[model samples]
Target: MDGDLRGWRQCLLSGAVFAVCMAGTTLPTPLYGLYQEKFDFSELTVTVVYAVYAVGVIGVLLLAGNASDAVGRRPVLLWGLGAATASAVCFLFATTLGWLYVGRLLSGLSAGLFTGAATAYVMELAPHGGTSRATFLATAANMGGLGCGPLLAGVLAQYADWPLYLPFAVHLALVACSAAVLLRLPETVRERRPLRTVRPQRPGLPPRVRSVFGPAAAATFVGFALFGVFTSVSPSFLAHSLDVRNHAVSGLIVALAFFASTAGQLAVGRFGLGRSLPLGCAALLGGLALLAGALWWDLLPLVVLSALVGGIGHGLAFRGSLAVVAAASEANQRAAVISALFVVAYAGISVPVIGVGLLAGPMGLEGAGLVFIACMMLLVSTAGVYLLRRPAPAAETAGQP
Candidate 1:
């Protein structure tokens, strides 16, 4: 009993650390307007700055995604915390657009490293038979931390004295404390390797895993596409179309989607993975519809509803996809396979967002969003149909080893 309590405590501590690192990524979400005012840039610049973080995440996932498996979780997470701190410091001292880009990229690197490592670390730290609860802890920390970022920043930026400076300073202090906490936690990996020995990761899939990977990756791509659009451009949409300019409200709206997603993820176990994927896709399709209505009519309530509903769909579909893929993958190849899954997910975040940015000038933000929704809707709907036609093979249904 004592050992079990100790293990749960460690897992919870790890989740907290993961949340702190992730919070830095979106800390600047609410402050983008402020940066624009100070630097005199366009909306395209904001999307580009946000997209840089995706690029950094994709780069890290491609190059060193398996570093934790090789060198141990604590060291990699410590490095992630360092990157996060650097990102915060960059935001604190930013006087140019370049600084924002640099900060976002570093933040992305921090997230890329933490995403897989921290997820695995949290699960591994759990006592035997506690996998289900640990999964929730890790995922809730991830999405909740992301939700908290804009909320924390928006509140601080809205009411606090140093709008930009205070948030990053707070995050920096949190990162330092996270580092200390991590130092005290026991290392999960038994055999650790030197950082130099970690080789560049190639994006590949073995023949055995390819069958399950296709549809799983597709669902993940669409889920993240939904999130990408919401996080990157929803605030601009809210401010311009609806004429709602409150930073706190905008942040909360975005946060609602992520929070709703946590709820959606929780439903996966109840619905079962096979059913959750298609059901999630159906919900996502509904969300896209709600988003379209909001865009067309310029209704604030519709937008909020779209965020909450769509976020739930995203959560359901994303966690279901992750579970499907993780369960199907071979023990030794799990990290690499998961990295490939994230590559698709991150692409959704980057490419569609840039497309929206490009089209914003010609078509306007509403039209661009509609176009994005239409495209993602088609993609997700197709995946849902496919999953329904042929459920994941029986071989792929087992949980991760």
Candidate 2:
């Protein structure tokens, strides 16, 4: 029908906007080293900067995660775009370490707002019975945009002039264009409310969801931790250890993990949740092992393999975790439960990375990475064994792809 076609078009357009906003979050990933050179900061400062973004994300998720449901998606998303624009501007004119932190925090706020609101918007814009494909579009847009961030920055930083300034400049333009597209798209929320109605949601789990939440949250944590490590520190490792100072190469290495995660997410429907969770765990374990090998032997091949394999594991486990948790929750409690999972995942991103940074001072990057890997490996293995013993219940029936 004509309506279906229109819905799909809108959905795609919204997804593009979503992607652009997310890309800005990672635009600075490849340029951290350049900032370090200019600012003369330590690696510990780098991880702290990265973790600050997670702090922003977590803060938003807890305080205003349901803002779109109250005030409508467009307003919240427009605010997200504004935050992203501020972030880009901060990066463009960054002179001190404080500027980078502020930029990263704003970037995180943009992502935190977009993550749930944009996803819900994309799905709502889809025609009836299009949930499955829309879910893929939203998730792909998320991870794909994240992948594009580093790649775009790295290429521009390597071959183009104004390495630090140009990327954010381009992102600012993209954000402006995205804002235009968003304005034209129809609002999905029918029940408009004042911002006063939006209440802060504390993370909570219903009794039913608690059983499945344990292993699922664990897998999600480890998966995100892997990503956290890759995005935050892998570039430094490549530059210092391998003497691979090419910005494009470092960006590509980080981007590969996110791209691979998107690919892995696409495969989950075929395997189903029951199988995917365990397989995801196994893959995560493999990724951690590959990273260990890369650290120990200083092998570039292993590093690449670790990104591919670990990315897949992250995708599989993350998606599967979402499905399993959704299946176990009562409908009214679903959003809060999902927020709890995200809290855990983002915590994984922040906590472990800061730990690595702390240890990096004494143990060196390689030793710190190995220690981090060893800890994540044990966690993933435990989750894997638990999933095998007790498969998640009713995921195929209740959860959407």
Candidate 3:
């Protein structure tokens, strides 16, 4: 009983650290407009800054995706925390557009290191028979932490003084606390190897797994794309289109999607993975339609509903996809497979957002957003129809256990 208690405590601590690290990545969500005013740049520049983080994340995932497996989780996590702290410091002192790019890039590197390593670390810290609970811990820490970022920043920016500086300062303090918590936890990896053993991450999968990977990756991509647009550019849309310029309101609106996603993920276990994927895609399609309505009519309520409902779809599909792929992968290759899945997911978030930025100047925010929604809607609808026509194999369904 005592041992079990210790393990649970350790898992909780690890999850908290995971949340803190992930929060840094999105801490600037509500503050982008301020940067735009300060630096006098175009919307294209904003998306480019956001995309830079994705590039950093993809770069790390390709080069050192499995670094923690060799060097021990704690070492990699410590470095992630250190990077997060540095990122906060960058934001605190940011004066020009270049500083924003550097801060975002460092934030992405921190998230890249944390995503796989922290999830594995939380699971490893769990006691036997705790895998199911630990999975929730990992997912919640990831999505929940993301939700908190905008909320924290928005509230601080709205109510407190020094909107930009306070948020980063608070994040820096949270990083310090998380680092201290990590020091108290025991190291999970027993045979830690040198960094030289870490090889470049080449995408690898057996022929059998490819069938499930296709639809799963599609759903993950569309879901992340929705979130990407919401976090990066939706504030400008709300302000310029609907005339809602309140920073706290803007932050809360973006945060709503992430919070709804957490709720949606919880629903997946009750709904069953096989059924949830297509259902989620359908919800996503509806969300896209609602978003189009918002764009065309300039309806604030429609935008809010679209964010909430669409976020739920993203959560349901994302967690279902993770379970499906993880079930199909062998234990030895699971880490690599999961890393590949995230590469696809983050690409969804990064590429489409950049496209929106590029088109914003010519088409305007609403026009660019409508184009994005149309494309994502088509992609998600096709995936849903494919899943409905040919359901996931019985073998794959059974593999989920």
For model 2, residues 9-83, the per-residue Cα lDDT tens digits are: 999999999999999998888888899899998888999999999999999999999999989999999999999
lDDT per residue for candidate 3 within 1-401, as digits (tens), equals 99999999999999999998988898899899988888899999889898888887888898888899999999999999988998898899998888899998999999889988999999999999999899889989998899889888988998999998999999999999999999989999999999999998876676767888888899899999999999999989888888888889988988889888988988987788777788889888888898999999999999899989999999888887877777788887776787788899999999999999999999999999999999999899888998888877732474364
* lDDT (10s digit) by residue, model 1, range 1-401: 99999999999999999999888888888788788899998878888999899998999888888899989999899999999999998999998899999999999999999998999999999999999899999999999999999989888887879998999999999999999999999999999888888888876687887877887777788778888888888888877778878888988988898899999999887787767777888888899999999999989988889888888888888887777777777788876787788889899888888889898989998989899889988888888888888788732364223
> Candidate 1 regions off by >4 Å?
207-211, 394-401
Which stretches of model 3 miss by more than 4 angstroms?
A: 330-333, 394-401
Worst 10 residues of 2 by lDDT: 392-401
- TM-scores across all candidates? 0.95, 0.98, 0.96
The C-alpha RMSD in Å for every predicted model, in order, reads 1.9, 1.3, 1.6
Better of 1 and 2 by lDDT: 2
The model with the greatest lDDT is: 2
How much is 192 displaced in model 1, in angstroms? Answer: 1.4
Which of the two candidates, 2 or 3, achieves a greater TM-score against the reference?
Answer: 2
Which of 2 and 3 is the better model by lDDT? 2
Candidate 2 wrongly placed segments (more than 4 Å): 394-401
Estimate the TM-score for candidate 1: 0.95
